[model samples]
Target: MGLWTVAAMTAGAVGAVALVPVALGAVGFTSAGIAAGSWAASMMSSAAAANGGGVAAGSLVAVLQSAGAAGISTATTAGLASAGAGVGAVAGRLIK
Candidate 1:
């Protein structure tokens, strides 16, 4: 493809990747904790129920909660970036 196409794809990828944290926070997954009555709270409740009154370590709920309480790890960031890049590439092709 052209340089502009590549640039657009790269920009899209970066933008999508950057939005991950913001989106997570928007859904009540913040550094402090999951907000009461928020989507995150609901997920936690479901997870706790499924796991016998406790969220299991390494489970999806626990992992997301950890990420929210702290921040996504380098590996998670890389994985998100890769997924974003794939999405960007697909979108760019569709737009063209």
Candidate 2:
């Protein structure tokens, strides 16, 4: 009803809106990274094969897997942090 209440409500709304994008951005970024890693691995494997280097594609596979796990972990961390921020914002508005 007052200016302080209106400001708090607006901030809470902004925080809520931001939470979704923060999560979606993490997902989108991770997907792009995995796709790029897969593409690079494929290209490297082909190049090695062409050069008669008997490329061990398995190493690339391992690297890709590791990258994927790390991406997921990072996304999860970001998502949790975003959730915490959202909760804090709501709690702050409510308490005030």
Candidate 3:
């Protein structure tokens, strides 16, 4: 694999890790939190795509939902979505 491949994977992993709280079934985040995350992730995905980046929409949404439902912060939601989108895009580019 190329360096980009590795880097992209790392980013994806980081984003996924951020949402780890959901796996445990309770993290104090509410439904609004998840919705916010999903919205942010959608925007992030669009932004990435507009900039000529492409990450699987399903994956992006899934990650954001998982993260949000797990109690992810509103303040950090945008940042996480952006980061995850970027990483997923990078990974898609490299792997493709």
Candidate 4:
């Protein structure tokens, strides 16, 4: 409820939102593609296996792949921002 808490929450929220793309990229999810032998590739493999050798549409792996290949949609971005804000608020409270 204080100034510092609000600032911390804002910063945390912004940081979480910004870091998502970078984190995805770092784990081999990029505009290019899922890098071979990378974590993304592994996830794809597992998802495919779980779905009888095919990655089902709308699955987590599929969604992430889509986001990586293209970019996150507005809805997804909004969801991420909300999650980020929630985490930020928690962090702010804890820090205080």
Candidate 5:
């Protein structure tokens, strides 16, 4: 794809990802202004057992930490995509 096209796609993807929280909140699925990172990190630990099964504290912590890390990683990926798109556009222009 052309560099400008890639840039446009990257921007659109980032925008879509950024809207996730807003959409979730609008649907009453998530609390307003609460970061997804915090939610992911605490959700497992805060959840009550559905089947009367208790989760081990240590395991719960590990799961929550991993989920939080994943959420952060997703944001990082979007940022990197945006940066790369800018770089690609510059390089493409210079090559012409």
Candidate 6:
């Protein structure tokens, strides 16, 4: 895949990982785990964006985050992740 493809994948993965904390938190797993996991994911995305590799990342993140915000359940995170990866893969072709 091209660079953009990788960026999108990375972004999607970051967004998916971001959900882990929010998911566990909803399940009553509120503790250091949520804080730690969220921090890690956020830091990674921040770094990517700072490095100018966040276009695809942003695309993936936007899709997954929007999906979740639209009320898609964690029950669908896995499926969403797959879909997001596919989106990332095609992002280069679609956007360029």
TM-score of each: 0.87, 0.28, 0.31, 0.87, 0.33, 0.33
Candidate 1 vs candidate 3: which has greater TM-score?
1
Question: Least lDDT summed over 10 consecutive residues: which range in candidate 3?
Answer: 22-31
**lDDT of candidate 2 at residue 29, scale 0 to 100:** 26
Candidate 2: minimum summed lDDT over ten consecutive residues — where?
25-34
Each prediction's whole-model lDDT (CA): 0.82, 0.51, 0.57, 0.82, 0.50, 0.57
lDDT of 6 at 55: 30
Badly placed stretches (over 4 Å) of model 3 are: 1-18, 23-70
Model 4: CA > 4 A from native: none
Judge candidate 1 against the unseen true structure and give its global Cα lDDT, from 0 to 1: 0.82
TM accuracy, model 2: 0.28
Model 2: clashing residue pairs? none
Alpha carbon lDDT of residue 61, candidate 4?
79
Q: lDDT by residue for model 1 over 10-71, one digit each (tens)? A: 87768866887888898888898998989999999999999899989998878777888888
- TM-score of candidate 4 to 2 decimals: 0.87
Estimate, for each residue in 8-91, the C-alpha lDDT of model 5 and write its tens digit. 656555665565445444433333222445553244335535324544555644443443334436655576567656655665
After superposition, candidate 6 runs with Cα above 4 Å error: 23-81
Q: How far is candidate 2 from the true structure (C-alpha RMSD, Å)?
A: 10.3
Query: For model 4, what is the alpha-carbon lDDT of residue 72?
Result: 73
Cα lDDT of model 3 overall?
0.57
Total clashes for model 5: 0
**Where is model 4 poorest over a 10-residue stretch in terms of lDDT?**
4-13
Candidate 4, residues 6-51: lDDT per residue as tens digits? 8777777677778888888878888888899999999989988888
